[model samples]
Target: MNQPPLPEVLDLAGEHFHTDQYATYRDILEQRPVTRVRFYDGSLVWLVNRYEDVRAALSSPRLSNDPTQQTDIDLSAATGIPDDLSEYFRRNMFRSDEPDHGRLRKLVTREFTVRRINAMRPRIERITEDLLDKFAATGGGDLVGAFARPLPLTVMCELLGVPEEDRTDFQTWSQHVVESDPAFAERNAASYRSLFECVRSLVRRRRDEPGEDLLSALVEQRDAGDRLSEAELISTVFLLLVAGIETSVNVIGTGAFLLLTHPGQLARLRADDALMGSAVEEVLRYMAPIEMTSRHSLESVEIGGVSIDAQSTVLINLAAANRDPARFEDPQSFRVDRNDGSHLTFGHGIHYCLGAALARAEAEIAFGLLLKRFPGLELAVPTEELTWRHVFMRGPVALPVGWR
Candidate 1:
């Protein structure tokens, strides 16, 4: 089968933000689950859009997550970002393979475990109530700016032992790294400086006077056994700060938007507490935050009738795969009662999101409380009128919602 043209990939991305690409994604999955396309820098890569193909691609040992192994595809060439910014990305767990990925992931997984996350539920509920209370006083507000953004950032800052006074700066820095457009190089540099300096200061403070937070725990572990390196410490903080904030914010923000927009789905979820977990899963599947993640083939592999060469780049379209009609019924509709867990939003295999439990806990508290607190909640603006961030990891820029 002939591969999709370069423009098709770009067109798909463009269509995704402006309109739902459910039909296009379904067509791609059915026609060419593992098809090749050119990235922004004009390098060709296999783009997988089917759930099974994406899961296989993620788990395949023939594929490597380490960008260092992808010498043929320069980070700058592939992403249209300066090579200097690549160093910041390369140091992180997201770009690492096993042993390294496992090591970094283990350092924080204990804190993000299901038990710890669930334990934080009451506190999360308190925090959600407090934020909603403030919003209630204002009559109407930008839900994303007023509630969604601050809630996750506050939780992450608290987890990492970051001081309250310094969180705003960190939030600004992290956003720059994720949305590094208009001027990718300069924004990333600023992000890196803020992040490194903040983490370094926190690490020093924790070393001197350890606290009860997760960062303090990690610091104590490092000091006691010399298990983690200085580089790992900073890199782990970077991961937590970036991943912690971006994923939670988008998940909560987008999930609420979906619920509000789909009244029938919202009604069902509100009527039954038993459906909240399934609602959360459907939310993750239907409005996946991270659209695509890249991996490189370590050896030649055949997938979906195409032979992917060794060292070839492969991009898993999480959004596309989750919406595959093969695995989902009425995939385009935001039905919370669907109760399917076949989503790739948290990824698959070993590279699955370590913070999945924590994110879900936060979202559950967020949406459950949101509906209860604002039973009269309704969108202040039309769906088409609301602005959306035009990026791979997409979310509503501002959700103007009103309630009595």
Candidate 2:
């Protein structure tokens, strides 16, 4: 059987925010919606970059989110965690399929309803204001380090009742897991182990003394019935901690960068605080934090005019899809008032992000508070000098800003 020539491997995992890369995605969208592209580690997956195709593929039940079916890569072998940690990681809903996914997600999602998130606005504002108070002291600093990064990490930890003392450690471990370099793959194991231990200890504590917190609710549900397993409990907590922090952190950082660069739109947003809702959606569409996600075909299925064999890998480039010309009028430009919130940044179908409401609330509060406080905020360094980390969720490494 002769195979077709593979498409040029796009380095979507590495350096982001490049013109040439987006140009390639646009080219792919127009020509080849579904094609094979090599990941940074030389692994090839069926890359789906078109807007319509990406949405269809994401919602298709024939394609499963379970990576266990992808024989091409042993995910555990790559991460190299201990058996207990590995098992816990496997139980996480991010990789779950069907019945188990519904069961696990149901147990934890009550804490993440839009109303619940809306209720947290006062607390979220307090945190945002406190962060700004410190930022105001120096008048300028890396917004990522000072404001973007810490804001979500703190909010999530506080919500889960994580000790004020251990929030920093939690942030460090979570970042290492997602942003790990291929060179430091071995260190990745230790990071997971540390996080696992921390989460396990927290679970145990919640059992002993239940409180007005998400973890306590989870612990109570675990005790009540067969609805949640022990490992699932730990994994759910882990997922909430990581997902809640990672997505919102990137949104705040990336959203702020887009606004800072597109001052006209920023001014428009500032002038009318009523536009905050649309503004956040526009930011998400402009620069998705989690650029790509992969799924394994459950059976031989057709996607984007290509026949994918059973157990084949499918990688959907959400960032590229969000920017597809077919979807938006001027996909390249950043507009704060863009009304559509159809971006696949959080994903689609059953696997859509559980903490989306939380992410949205955080962004709305973070942006609203920051703009109100630092009306003079602007980049401290030239745009070219700004460094972006090639993490699973891409955002500025250090978004230095100055306020007049």
Candidate 3:
């Protein structure tokens, strides 16, 4: 009912994750911590910038994660999913709330037990080695495209039973799905259809001819009990492919950037292999790729000392929260040995990232291999020249690197 008094309109468009942007968020946090801003799609959303407010909103049951409840955002255009399939996409655990979210998370969490994830170490390392073999051959290459993109993509595809044929050339579509650039706000509906249709076909095929893959296991779960639905089956596959690939890809890409830029930390990590876990956690904290997520107010709730009415759209700034001076000491600096991995990088609450462990494992292994293989690795292009994308699934578009 009121307008943003000139300064409240923040851009969530195709803007690079520039340093000044963080300062802007810091300013917002210090002043109106819980305020409104317009997203790139011309959709107005309540932006929560302060650490406590963001953390509370992320886990608060009073705020709903269901995209269908959102009146401000045009879900159809933003997500690039058709009407029939949009419901399935929206019902995915990431977007679902309550018992449904719990059930979906429970089923997937069972599949990611320590034993199962540990078993994949060999395969993950093997994939990283194979990718490194190629990267080293190029004397260096675009790390994002060459190594970061394919390694996790291969691992996720193989683990989820997504055929190799369906994995290539799909990143651009997923990137658009996560971001809304004013210049390219027009989403490619065809590409989105092909993506979902491909996954849907794979789901059906897995049912008819099950395999020893995670998707088949999920299919078995669906068949054994009414716990999983057809829509959910598609949605799970959708999440594993999109979030699994995208999340891990950006973490690996940017994690490498961190090591490259902060050589002292890089040297410290290289000196000790045990720091791999801590280093990964530090990277997640320092620069959470999924900078922000939304929650629709289920009831009138007080956040950041301000009472927000029910049904109001709220944006939780994960990146800002991760770097909050109150939560983290010298939050701006990158520390490889920052053992206190309590940052809300993977998020908090029931909606905490399902694939967080897997993402961490991949990054640790990927970074370790890079340290061992490319001792003197440095950015092929200057840092300022790097391209960043997506207000949501964000990361360097192309990470060119060279090494001795």
**Against the true structure, whose lDDT is highest?**
2
Per-residue alpha-carbon lDDT of model 1 for 1-404, expressed as tens digits? Answer: 55353244543335533465655566677666777665545556778778778888888888999887875555653333455445554666677888888887777788888988888888888888999999999999799988999898888888888999888888888877776243465566666676777888989999999889988988887789887777677777778888888988888889989888888889988899789999999888987877788888888988766898888888888998888877778787887778788799998889889899988988888998889989999999889998766446678888999975
For model 3, the superposed segments whose C-alpha errors exceed 4 Å read 1-6, 14-19, 169-172, 182-185
Error of 3 at 110 (Å): 1.6
lDDT digits (tens) for residues 135-209 of candidate 3: 788887899999998988899889888777677755666655555444543465655676777877887899899
- Give one digit per residue, the lDDT tens place, for model 2 in 1-404: 33333246555444322444666667677667787765546666788888888999888988888766677755655455565567687787888898889988888778788888888889989989999999899868888888888998988888889988888888888887775355666777888999988998998888899899888888888898757888888888888888788888889998888899988999899889999999999888888888888899989998878998987878888988999988898999888878999999989988999888888889999999999888888998989898775534678878989988
| lDDT score, candidate 1, position 18 | 46
Clashes of 2: 0
Query: Which residue pairs does candidate 1 place in steric collision?
Result: none
Model 3 pairs in collision: none
Q: Candidate 2: give the clashing pairs.
A: none
Query: What would you estimate as the lDDT of candidate 1?
Result: 0.79
Q: Which stretches of candidate 1 lie over 4 Å from their true place?
A: 1-19, 76-89, 180-183
Worst lDDT run of 10 residues, candidate 3, spans 11-20
lDDT for position 294 in model 3: 83
